[model samples]
Target: MDWEYFFELLLGGLTRGSIYALIALGYTMVYGIIELINFAHGEIYMIGAFTALIAANVLTMLGMNELAVLVLASVVAILYSAAYGFTVEKIAYKPLRQAPRLSPLISAIGMSIFLQNYVLLAQTSDFLPFPSLIPELEFMEPIAHIISSAEVIIILTTAVVMILLTLLIKYTRIGKAMRATAQDRSMAMLVGVNVNRVISTTFVIGSALAAVGGVLIASHIGMINFYIGFIAGIKAFTAAVLGGIGSIPGAVLGGMVLGWTESFATGYVSSDYEDVFAFALLVIILIFRPAGILGRSTTQKV
Candidate 1:
């Protein structure tokens, strides 16, 4: 066994896992708050990537520096993606809150389809090239042969975002309200928490995180298509379920594990079966530990 080759795969897995973690956070957060799966969340990530692509082109035309352009483009993409998230909740989800569970589930799937086609029509169906705005770090030249600057950015960004999210959920007034609502929506309302506001905020925050993932992943891959969201969404959903669907930390852990699984499978076995490895792992986890690594099992009164 080549140890160096193993380490290379490990680094690659970490970079991919970081993106999955960001996307999974959206799924887990929405589920944690409303007990609903926002299946359309992945499309939000795709749109964010497109938004960044357009923004970067516009900024480049204005002759901005690479760093400034990247920063501005990211900001614009995040804001636009958050708006879409808020709109999705108000239109597709809010009215169906009291309906049967399957109703909203279907609605979410429909929304996912709508967004994919919308992008296909608005933007070309072709794979668009994403700009490489992240500059190489000279200080890391010694290890540049092993790990690229983009991978470093991905890992650091994931860490920073996760820390900020943890702080927000722990310290802020809104954070407390979110926790209360997640614990018990009826009880939270009785205590004066605005259930609607909390739900909207959850969508917005989750969407923003997805946007960040989109921007970073697009930059890393250098190309994207309208269909990119579907596969990524499924993988992220699996990660969320594997880690304990409603557990925040579990999503991150699940993503990393899934990423590593794919990497090692591709390295040792066959690249064609990489996805099979992920699903196979998901089935095993479901059979043995349905609640996930960090998720708590709950019992309901009949």
Candidate 2:
């Protein structure tokens, strides 16, 4: 544990935190609106990364430059994931909204399994290498260090996206509709808010964010398997819980906390036990402050 090691780990943690935060937003937004956990969200993330990878490879095969291919891939991945998310909501969850709550949860889980198997079948189950859009760079300051250009891009990209999302949700007309729907669906419908449209929009936005996260992480890590989403989803869900499930800002804070916790734990303890520390912290947080750090507790009317 030297200063350089500390800074490097911190930087890595922050980048990872950003990805987790993005994915957590998808979870929190859906939960806020319907109180159902979308287990397929992780699979959606996995597909996003793969979609980007496939797009980039196809562009390269068609003789496009790497930079251009990267741009196209990112755009395609986001759009594809957003559309897929919207469809999932319309076809899978929308019809079940009025049914028993457990129905949607089961459907989500089934979708998750289906996605995992589908990907495994379509593209070999073995881990595939992700394309690197950004070159590696070294910090030439007092502490010379190596950092990927992707890391810088991931952090900045995610930060800008988060800020834009905040603005969208806080100031835009659709944002108000989203809030109204989240508050009370029946009242929102009475007030002229199209509940279906709002829900669809929410899914599209959240899924697109997750897609961006998936692309960034895939580029940074360089390899991904179909099962990657399982752990990542759990961690993102933990982040949502840690930040107060329905609060957008809380997800960001929770993601950073969870990322830093794992980073420090691995640095001080053992990498083998990194996962244990993460869940342990989650349990501790839940036990002491179930509402989360920035979350306001609410009571349900019986």
lDDT (CA) per prediction? 0.93, 0.87
Worst 10 residues of 2 by lDDT: 138-147
What is candidate 2's lDDT per residue for 1-302, written digit by digit as tens?
A: 49978888898788788879879989988888778898889888998999999998899899988778878898999999999889988888999989999999999998889889999999989989997865555552333254467767887876787688789889999999988998889999998999999999998988888888888889889988999888899999999999889888888889999998888888888989988998899889988999987777888979
lDDT of 1 by residue, 1-302 (tens): 89999999999899888889989999999999889999999999999999999999999999999999889999999999999999999999999998999899999999999999999999889998998877788898899988889889988988888788889999999999999999988999999999999999999999999999999999988999999999999999999999999888889999999999999999999999999998899899888897987889998868
Q: Give model 1's TM-score versus the native structure.
A: 0.98
Supply the global lDDT for candidate 2: 0.87
- Residue 76 shift from truth in candidate 2, angstroms: 0.8
- TM-score winner among the candidates? 1
Superposed Cα deviation of residue 251, candidate 2 (Å): 1.1
Q: Write down the TM-score of every candidate.
A: 0.98, 0.94
Q: RMSD for each model, in Å, please?
A: 1.0, 1.9
lDDT of model 1 at residue 87? 100
Native-to-model Cα distance after best TM-score fit, residue 72 in candidate 1, in Å: 0.4
> Residue 208 in candidate 2 has what lDDT?
89
